[model samples]
Target: RRKAKRGQPPKPTPPPPVPPIEADEQVFAARLRGALYFFSSAKNRNAFLAHPARYANAPPPTSFLPPTAALLGPEAQALPLARTLSRKLGLVVLSLDEAVKWVLQGASPLAEILRPIVESGTPVSPLHQVQALQLRVSSPDTLRRGWLLLGAPVDGKIAEIMRVCSVLPSRIFGICAQHADASIAGLEAALKEKRLSHRLAKIDSSRNPLAQQHEVERVLLPLLRLRQQAVAATAEGEAHTAEGLEVTDDDFVAKLNPKFGFYCPVTWLNERRLHHCGDGEAAVAKRCAAEYKGVYVCCASDKQLSAMLLRPEEVLAGPPLPSPLPTKETQQAAAYGVSPSLWAELSGHCPVTLARGPKLGDYASRALALKEGKKEFCVEYESKRYVMASAECMEEFLATPWKFSRLTLPSKLLPASDPLDVGELPTRGYSEQTLGDSLKAALTDLLTLERPKYPTLSCTETALKFVALHLKANNPNVRAPHLKHKYSSKLHDYTERCGLLDAIMRTARSNGEVAAHSTASAATDATEERDQGRPGPEGSEPDQTTATAAHSESAACKKASEAPMPDLATLFKAWDEAVAAGLDIH
Candidate 1:
């Protein structure tokens, strides 16, 4: 090789650093087809369309200023607005309806296939739609100027069309919401008669109405999707490729499904109305076009209407609720019911054990009320009107009800065979290998012998207290935590071993239930709110007869209240008298 001359050549400096190859001036055209090859001028465009393969290796055209001009709206707006958007925006508005009609008029081979489907409810397939759009937007000139795409990317096909195409609309210049749901009645009547197409065609307002360029400006300004900030940042910077974009169809579909879809014309009440759909009025107009016989249901709400009408396609996945079933501690004011928070609450543990009534030797698991005129007062410790009967002898019970109110009772118990089950007798349990037999013997000896002793006092007050005191005095070791009564250590050992606590409570609740039933009618008139521990109905005292009977009952109650503790033998004699008098006893 000869050495380079110093001044003449200077080694050519690597050919001025090879400039990057620019893409051909255009890659797409409007209403023209050439094997995806772009041309710079009309001469080159025609040359390429004539024989696309001759330029098979045509360098990809550099990205044109993206089609910043977008024309999207519902089908309703598309019919009237497409012509206007054409003149106003100076965009070659490719209305899908016009395109389909144009194709069918020429009876292109693809249009021949699309005609029947297009005439019927079904849209031309996504592929066919893309191809048709390709023919329109493929021209080299159209790609650079960026013509407006009007209403082909309808519901259920937007993503497929967008991803399959080599480009996307960079700017959304306008959105129009046709107030169709608001005027549903007219559409419904037209649809019901199947004369909607005829009526729409006949409508003078739709055909040659005064063009309100003002209307376009008004609607476009308020409904422009991108804010000023968003507009300042153009998406043109994104690299353009002749290759189709790859995206998961599912993600696109899911994001778009809720935002845009075909709504039935039928109303929520199922009235005859075609539901308007799509984001733009223009898009909605396309669907409503007579060429497409598709049916749609009305959207469920204004949100659905507005979102499909004007909202941009954005994903909004809401958070889920914690549970299907919610608990209620307090009733809402809307319920028009008493607040659950204000209502009386009950503890699960038995109220019988927490009551102080037992300490006074007056043990009953229920509260009996004494009626005086209109109001009733509880005889239990304090003013607690629950299932507790008072021990007239115990003052300690009034101070603390929770400590001794709860009562637990044995279940599945059988009564004793002998009539003298409650008599003071030491019935022994026989040990047995079988669990059932052993438990049975133990319960029987306990329940029949020392538990639920025969009533001994002449008065109800004396008898009830005496039984409570007797058991506690006899049984000491075991702590009946619910029972406020103190037991003697030595005297109560046998009582504790018998496990007769349940039997005693069982008998007490039984007698209380019986007493409740006997006077339930009178108590019904007292107050239903008594169950809520509220005061009885305010009213005049019962008539003279009621007052007389109450007086007599009061006298008996007073006498019982004043009675002293009676001997066990005297108490048993009183029980014998009650038995002879045909009163039930167990």
Candidate 2:
């Protein structure tokens, strides 16, 4: 190529070709003292640089490895660590289904039945699996063994099972739910392969095994910690076992790394020279030398880190747990962020319109309809009424009236309300009828299922939960207003009352006693007529029953009706039993 003119610099060479590796040459590589490099194209190098896990092999043919070798990578890297830890702890892992079948009376009976079903068409029912679990845990001997239950999931009923166990004050230590990034196609492929081959199928050769190990770690942590707790409680007189602390394995890894003092506190990546380590860094640099996979740090040396990485549950013994459940006090405090006022004062005697929120005419030229056309449902807050375009929106708006009341929804006012006049919109949305009638109509339409199949527990809490479950089932985003809202109180109280009557109605219907109750109600009406001696309407006359009939019937009814509504716990217990009884679990 000809050289450039004297003033101009020579043109740079074109991009270099990727250096192909020889038969014996390394395919990928990284450096500890400097940035990771690749002999392949820039894209390949960049990809590896971004995430070391992408290329981390379980064990290289040779001992040479980058400093960050034992990172959050190919899960196979964790197997040896897990095996070492399990051996140390002396624990046994129980496949939940096998354990269930073993625990159940007459194992042959279930196996013979399930085998044909499995061979024919239907997969083993998740419900049956749960039943097997119930049987397994019921036995006292199963609890004593240092064992773990894994792999039997009962569809959407894990919550229900936990609810049932909660009644027994379940001895569960911790649950680690691993939320991993895996494609649907990949999972389906694995399942299909397993079904077709009749052998073990690995979904993600890298991630799945690590996930299983982490789950065991989460459970083991609590089990070991609780034993310590029991020892301490012996002297302190306080509860020893800390139950129900769910944490992820990755989070545990992240937390433990801080104690190791090798990784940077801020970046959470392994550190370089003369940064945060101080005198400890120098001591590490001299006495300990990081070679290949082993990273020599002060708090934990290479071999120590390898062991800790597998089972760091000990360092996570006591408090400092993340994400505690919210309390009533905290909820009440949240409401106090803004001032509270009466419905009349806030609505200005206008119908509350969820379609056009409380802030309708404040900023824009006029209140306008949302992109979607208006829907239905009108409710009242105390005396002033509010209109929700949809049942769901109304639920959300009512759930926290105070928050919504001070603000407004985006809207365009009707032509009649032009000029954005002094007063809020007129009461056009809510009907002139009594608010109770309107609310009842809406609720009746809302509660789709029959009343009698309901749990025989407290109606108050159950009804509230049922309504929430029902609403969310219909619309995921449905919300319930704060307790302070009169609408909320009214809706909840109404639901409870309806639940009681509906329960009675359902019982009467099922028992074929509706005819008897009607006859009784009619006879009682005649007796009241006879006592009052009032003339029948228009020209009709009434028949009479025994004098003692009304007294006995009324008194018995009153006694039966006076039973208090059950609480939420009792309701869930009843629901669990009711659901379990109906499942096809052998």
Candidate 3:
């Protein structure tokens, strides 16, 4: 039955203009047929198509024809059936669309066959609709096969075919070079002769440093694939090979499976700043295009990145030279085209520090607010937060929350003394781990104060006093307690070990000093009753109770000195005090 049609069969896309069936085209076509014949597994058209250009002459073929006749003959002339037949013996014949389908279906053929047809007569692309073209040609024998796809027009029919065939393999998989002005007409003729077929996927031009240098992504997709066979063949020969790059960091390489490359702003920008020269705009634009290839980073603030780019010495020597500021339009473009969250991740990690919040006059500040502040939002996943403005989030937002967050909670809490070792993150949560470690370090510093035992109260109170000293020395807001009752309670915990308190009261009593005005009130209170052995006024009982109080305080201090303190919380009442006191204790 015919499939229901919602629209007219796509208007026939005209074939690209043919190059004068040159010696180059003929050689390229012959080599392509050779590859289709050689590696023609029904399931591996793309793998076959992507065989390297360098391998064009490898492993002598089963059949051979004089290069001139087989390649240069007219389309209507009797063909080189022997060479084509060699492909049939090598593998099974499958339609271009069915090639990928066979791979997906896991169909393996005992033999491979080549079916070359010119689809220039097939009306698939329409002039009005701007459709992407992908070209996949299974011919490792010719370097020009890769060039044809690259040369196909962006707007022309040949370009569309190349765009659709982006998934197809080429002779050179890992590194490629292409010309921007090659005609679509030539590509159409090649297609009409069944030299190329549509692969129907986007080519990633991101990895080829030369793709943008040559302006290929605009006209065509450039890709770098790791051919296992090529890599294995060249592994023993060269440290780095023309066949394929060795996977140096397998873990890192795994992250780029579907995508061919990744952008690391830190290394990329660092390298750029060392070499780049010119005004800030030109330098940044040039460097961004050169290094990051239009990827946006959200981790580093513009000011921080600018400082990294321009350096402090450069900033000071000039009269505050203007830098490349991401325009509101650029930020908007990044938010729309790039992963906003990933951009944030990159920007946040950038080597600059800026004051938090928004500003009115600065363009970058305003741009940041528009694209990443108010426009940005968060979603909860696996009990943690993830930025929504990311490419992964956009693709997997509703599909899988747990997988997106990539959270793996430890089964047990680590001892406060032991540092927790978190592995490299799968997402943008590095700052969270860093902050936690900093907090723990601060707390540990506060706890170490108890080692040099004082004849003071429990070591816990000594820790508190250390904390109090820190608060007084650094932060301005902390002050003496408001309530006398609270102060007495805070000090009571320390009185027993501080033997100086007994001496303090004796001195105060001998001098007839006012109890309220004395410098050592806390000390005096601890030992006054022990020295005097007396009660209070005629009508009231004394503030100091019995000998039992002294005994209890002594025991508590001794016990504290023996055991390791767990946290600043066990010593100080607040977190602010622990950080302030961490230094004092040390």
Candidate 4:
């Protein structure tokens, strides 16, 4: 290279050319179908390269997707599907009916027009319906994570209205029953007319509801993966900035031991005054008396060791070591009956009782229950000891170990006597595992050997009764043949010693069924009247009498049918009372 002239700077050297297929040093990249692909690690890269043909034309990985989605079809099919999705995914469910109710609760003029139609179960006009939906979608909570729209209209005009209102879902699904209905057909036509066929998918409600969930999940897997990526990225970004300040003794004050320090407020510290209290304890006391205010002085060997400032506001006004210390460990131990050592040892474990509750799938509840696990009632499964509340719970575990185990065991390891056989459990179909675990937990709690146990009945007999009642009330379609066979002798005993059996049977008929029956009866009455004779007139005495009787009948039918299924709170209360009384639950 030639030297530059005295006054001029030498020309800079050009950087080397980067390879077209270059990737991060930490990332592995490979060529596939003349295009470069990246993997998180060498193992992933190798796996991809092993089957390049399978991934050559694959869609590019997406990093983020909004959670907005719409479910259109019959209310019977769509509402349940929306609720299931809300539970499985963290999406909020927003139904058109709920929106209309919200609108009616507000001062909007449309509420008056929509009220009669809503009460009569007639669909509101598309324009007014979309307007209500728009209000709900614009809410901060719904906009933050998005919502799963239920019972959305399938008319093209409604879709256009939603689009214009900026509340249209990113994805639209038509929930169809085993036999397609006119509404489902209308949804398909709307999708085609809107040129949104690519965004439309159909979920069949005829199959097991869980199976239907699986189909929806399969379609949403890509979007779910994108959401996961976005969440991870956000967490990583926050990790760098969310570090707490390093605490030090200077940040707090102490009355007795310096180690046990209380936080000092910054405002108090800023407002504090400094004074030299002489060199001795006597002098410091004199100075404190003269000040006529609370003062903190550093002392050593009954002498003033430091001239540090003191703030009356900063000094805690109560006696040291107050009656109840404000510490989480102490509060948690007292509330949950857990020792510190036990908490430390089994902080990660889940108790059999709480784990079997309806909220078994909640992480917070699981963590809390872990501390409540009793050492006396425990069982070893796959070399891990799990704590149970009672012997009945342990037996339930033995009967269905897979249901309680945190680890997902392989089919080969499952017991042969499992009520829900491992082979029969759906894989990637739905959250049946969670449902089964909750059911078993509820049964175990009710059948524990503690007082309130069914009088003169074995644990097996008690469990059979509870299971039969629960299934018949909540899931009438589900058949427990094994339970039926095992408890055949005790099945006929419906003695209402505890009143639970009566309550369950009373709630078996749902309000919807009652309403449908009344509607059918009214239609039959109308047809008979038309065929027999015309009503004398609108305000005739005969017509008025007939209408009054029909109204009374409908009202009575609704009142009788309004008894809902026994919720968790009611069941637990009844269980406790029966156990205390030692009465027959069936």
User: Across residues 321-398, which tens digit of lDDT does each residue of candidate 4 receive?
Assistant: 222221112233335454323533233233456455445455554434333444554555555556555556655554
Estimate, for each residue in 1-586, the C-alpha lDDT of model 2 and write its tens digit. Answer: 2445556777665433333333323345544234344434446655655654445432443211110000122324433433444465543333445744564434555556666665686766655555555555544333433433333221224423433442111122112223453422332244243221111122333345556456445545554564454344434433221122222222223333333343322211222111222223332221221111122222324443443333334422313211211111223323443322222232222223433443335534334432221213333343443444454554444434444444443344333422343245455433333234544544665565345223344545555555554443343234544423544555455455445545644454445444445556866786788778776775555434444676577656555455455554665565467567895311
Candidate 4's TM-score reads 0.27
Better of 1 and 3 by lDDT: 1
Q: Residue 313: error of model 4 in Å?
A: 59
Question: CA RMSD for every model?
Answer: 30.6, 31.4, 29.5, 36.7
Global fold similarity of model 1 (TM-score) = 0.24
Candidate 3's residue-wise lDDT over 9-31, tens digit each? 66655433322212432132223
TM agreement with the true structure for every prediction: 0.24, 0.24, 0.19, 0.27
Q: What is the C-alpha local distance difference test score of each model? A: 0.39, 0.39, 0.32, 0.53
The top-ranked prediction according to TM-score is 4
lDDT of 1 by residue, 159-234 (tens): 3354356433433323332343332344334333431221111111232324434544444443233222122222
Worst 10-residue lDDT window, candidate 4: 239-248
Q: How high is the lDDT of residue 580 in model 1?
A: 94
Q: Which stretches of candidate 1 lie over 4 Å from their true place?
A: 1-4, 7-40, 43-84, 101-112, 115-211, 221-586
